[model samples]
Target: MNKSFPAIFALALFLSVLLFNYAAAQSTVQERIKQVENNLTENLQTNDAGPMNLQKRMEHYKVNGLSIAVIKDYKIDWVKAYGVADAASKIPVTDQTLFQAASISKSLNAVGVMKLFKSKHLDLFADINTYLSSWKFPYDSLSKGKKINTANLLSHTAGLSVHGFGGYEPGTPLPSVIQILNGTKPANSGAVRSVFEPGIRQQYSGGGTTITQLMVTDISKERYEKYMSDQVLKPMGMLNSTFAQSPAGLKRGLLATGYDVGGKEVKGKYHIYPEQAPAGLWTNPADLARYIIETQLAYEGRSAKVLDQETTKLRLTPYMNAEAALGVFIEDYNGLKYFGHGGANEGFRSGYYGSLAGGNGLVIMVNSDNGEIIQELINSIATVYDFKGLNKTEKIKLANVSEKDLDSYLGDYQLTPKLVLTITREGKQVYAQATGQSRIEAFAETSSKFFFKVIHANMEFVKDDQGKVTKMIFNQGGRIEAKKL
Candidate 1:
């Protein structure tokens, strides 16, 4: 054989090996995606087998649309979308459809704030009033001689008022950031004032985040949205995200419409959140995966697109609380720590998690008020990928109670002026429907205690000396006592 013939045969063999490896990698990705699609689990499993497939769970939760992105090796392995963007229009959800990030905005806001710290534009431990130009925080006796700092704002340790906001509806005139701070005319929330001594303990304050929003503008001499877009989100390669209260530039049908738990469209499509730092960013799962990937890379000192390795470490470190770090909470699963944040806006629920090591992360967004399915999906993904301790499946057992006992607990329990949890019975099974939420069955675990299968909530029926039901102790994230009304 000629010398040229030997060279040509070697080149052909190299090309064949490359092609075979690429095909094998693609096969692995598709297999993982398929496993996640069919493995959706419930937070509370019952004797009855409900829907487990991805599409069936979406319908079972009455969710109109949802998107997911899984990250591996500091890169997005897959991004998937399911259901409709708008149920009324029958538009299918695509990977590009943006969902409201809600309180998840706080996580990114913390990044922006930390970037300011990195540049020495302002001090995170300095009194926020140092950079605030338009409004001043009213230092009342509630502060107890302590000063509120930007660090406190990010860590929810400032002890400020207003746990969260009820966003304005479409056609309603929006409030300026100053108006929101002062709770002036056109602002629906109360003024952001001190409720207790600063730095004493952790108390959630969306109002405190709004303070940092103004400080950002004051220090940078730029709009909060623009500064974040240019310095934080864009540099991190999150191009499909925005802090616009009204996302005006989006192409038609790119923004997913929000839906209630009952599958009804939210009037005006969605509420307008002018509180950009706390709950205003609109983004999709794929874009959020980039933020997580950047964080993971920077944590390992591998990448520093916006924040250098040192500053990224500061942002992830817990400030005062064990879990409530600067912007995101550090969740310890087994012994591995994962940073995460959850968001809930009107007719929208979303969540994201990034492991401290292994370069592993996942983002999930949904355009429905019912958040029960979101946790269930996380459990399923965590189980498949071995994200230890995130699997929160509690195989619940049902207890049979006498019909008379079940009937005694039937009535409306007034939780708030606007919210009432109504307990009803259909034959022997009891059900509960909270105001503006879908009705869920409340299984009797005991004669007085009942729990829900779709969400991790417990309702313990209380009785008086006469043995008549008087009130209900609703326990989920916290304990709330509601008198039977």
Candidate 2:
């Protein structure tokens, strides 16, 4: 054989090996994705409805678009997107599609604000009014003379009014920070004022988070978005995120349209959140995964990209015997600690859970008002990844019951002084609604027992000696009680 022939044969062999390895790696990733899509479960065994196909569940829940990022060993393993970002345009959601982060904004806002504390520019325990130069907090006797501190505000222990915000429609006039705080005409929410003494209890308040937003703007003397982007977002390598009140210029095209529970598009496609610090974040799950990874690394003292180890520890620590931490919530799931935050703004719902150790985490974003799908997806990822303390689901099977039998369970059962469980029926389907909440369908597990698909709660209709339904027993969170009206 000629010398040229030998050289050509060797080069061909090298190319074949490289191609084979690349194909094998792609196949492995696809297999893992397929596995994750099929197995979704919840913490409670009774809540599991068996192995589920994620695409089918998306159809079942009418979720238009979803994005998820999985973190392994302190880095993002993969990111997946599904459904249409804009149903009208049929634009598919991609790795770059942006969804409203909603209350998840608070988590990052806390980081930016904490940086101030770390730099000794602000005191975590100092009275918030001390740094607030523009507007003063309207304190009253309800405060019990307990001044609201930066830590209390960040932890939602400031006892402020307004649990959350109902973002303004795209065309509606957005309120200024001061206008929102005073609950002025342009503001759709109530005034942000003290409801009770600060640090007394852990009650959620988006209004309190807004106060911190103002504090950042006032103290930094820079726009909230600019300060956050420079100090936190850019530092953490989250280039795809923004706190813009409206989707303008090039960012508008990247935004996923919001959808309601009925599968209808939101009136303006998506709401505009002027409360930037609390609900204005527009980002994708891939970008959020970066935040989670940074948090995990900082907590472990391996990295301080955005926050140092000591500050990260303070951010994750629970306050006032409550699971609520600074902007995020700390939970011990089966012994593994998780720091996370959930966001809901009109037709958008997002959540992220990052392990305090082990560098494991997940971030999910959906452009739908119905959030039941988010948890299911999280369960699937946790199961497929074998995330410690995450898998706790058992299979559940529904029982068939007659429509007439279901009608018998229709009635109002009072649970507490202000809460009532109302059961209703339509054809063969049964539904349950609590006071001040939307109605949810309840699937029959037995003639007298029913379970909710959206939540991990169950109901049992109790009968009297005469075989007539007299009360309804609600079982949830280890509490079982009979309610009769």
Candidate 3:
């Protein structure tokens, strides 16, 4: 027997084992992807909580399109696209299709501001007026004479108003940043003034973020979109991403058209956001995965594509708000930390999260006003990946209420002069439809109390001494009495 025969046999065996392992690993990956697709759960889960198919889930939520990218072991494990870019045009989502980043742009905006601090010596703590040659924040007595800084703007602690923007409809003139800050004509939004003194607490001001948009333009002498494209997005390997309000150079057919909660197409397809820093960005989940991976690597001091280790740490550290860091929000889950942000524009809702350890992350984007699907998808992903403390589904049990009781709660309750909440009973199901919105089913929590799964609100039917329903106490952010008519 030749001695070389034994060696050759050993080598062949090793190669066979390697090939088998690779094939098995790939099979597992496919299984996980299938599980994620087939297991989309509802936030308000019922006792009949069977795992839902992704397409069914999309139909249930009236979402037009969705894009997803999951990161595992510091790399994108998988990327999947679902549904159509536009329901009318029937364009499918390939994920080169761009969706508005919305407020998620603030996350990268923080990176841009920190880059200025690192490279250009812009003081993060100095008065924002120092760098505002184009326009200054009109800090009246509302500011209490305290100065607002770059950090405050990034962390949303500037105490500014204008929670968010409603983008301009088609053919409408876009507002200049100055006009926007002043709430002048064509801006549509109110003046971004101090609602309270600066540095009071965490007030989410896209207005403040817009001010930093100005600061970036003023300091860099470049358009916000161009500067972001050159300095931050490109550097992070997010080649497909842009801060352009109307993203140019994108393929003619790649922009996903917007849709409303009722599945109606946006009149102009999608509104134009001149508020670029706070709301304007057009990118997909794949590009977002690159951004998340780079951030995770930078946090671990293994990479410095856009931010160094020290600056990255500073960016992740909570500023004025415990959960809100510079551009991202940091939440601790049983000692496991994560940083992420969610975004919404006129017809789009998106969210992304990257774990501080283990390099696990997920990005989800949809071209519909309904955000109910996003959280449900996240719950499924969290369960599949065993991401500690990431699932936030609320399983609710329906209370015993007679069909007659539900029907008694039916009536038009005048919430305001022009607004009425019309509660209608269809068969045995109780549905609440606003004046111009779609009907949402309210599950019975008790005899007189009802809760909505789509919207986070509850209503209690107030009965008179005669056991006649007279009013409804609607509690959503605040309690209000709506007299039944």
Which residue pairs collide in model 2, if any?
45-394
| Residue range 1-485, candidate 2, lDDT tens digits | 69799899999999999999999988987888899888765444443346778898889989999998999889888899999999998999999999999999999999999999999889999899999999999889999888999989888899889999999887788889999999997999999998888888888999999999999998999999899999999999999899977756754458999999888999988888889999999999999999999988898899998789999999999877648999899889667899999999888999999998889999999999988878877778887887766554556666778766677788899888889988888887888998999998887888789888678799998888887888887888876575667
Lowest lDDT 10-residue stretch of candidate 2: 40-49
- Decide which is better by TM-score, 2 or 3: 3
What TM-score fits each model? 0.90, 0.88, 0.94
lDDT of 3 by residue, 36-93 (tens): 9988787778657777888888998788899999999999999889999977778899
TM-score of 2: 0.88
Candidate 1 has what TM-score?
0.90
Candidate 2 residues lying further than 4 Å off, grouped into runs, are 1-22, 42-49, 392-440, 443-447, 455-457, 471-485
In candidate 3, the residue pairs with backbone N, CA or C atoms under 3 Å apart (3 or more residues apart, or in different chains) clash, namely: none
Give one digit per residue, the lDDT tens place, for model 1 in 244-299: 87888778888899988888989999999999999999999999999999998898
What lDDT does the true structure give each of the candidates?
0.90, 0.88, 0.90
**Ranking under lDDT, best-scoring first?**
1, 3, 2
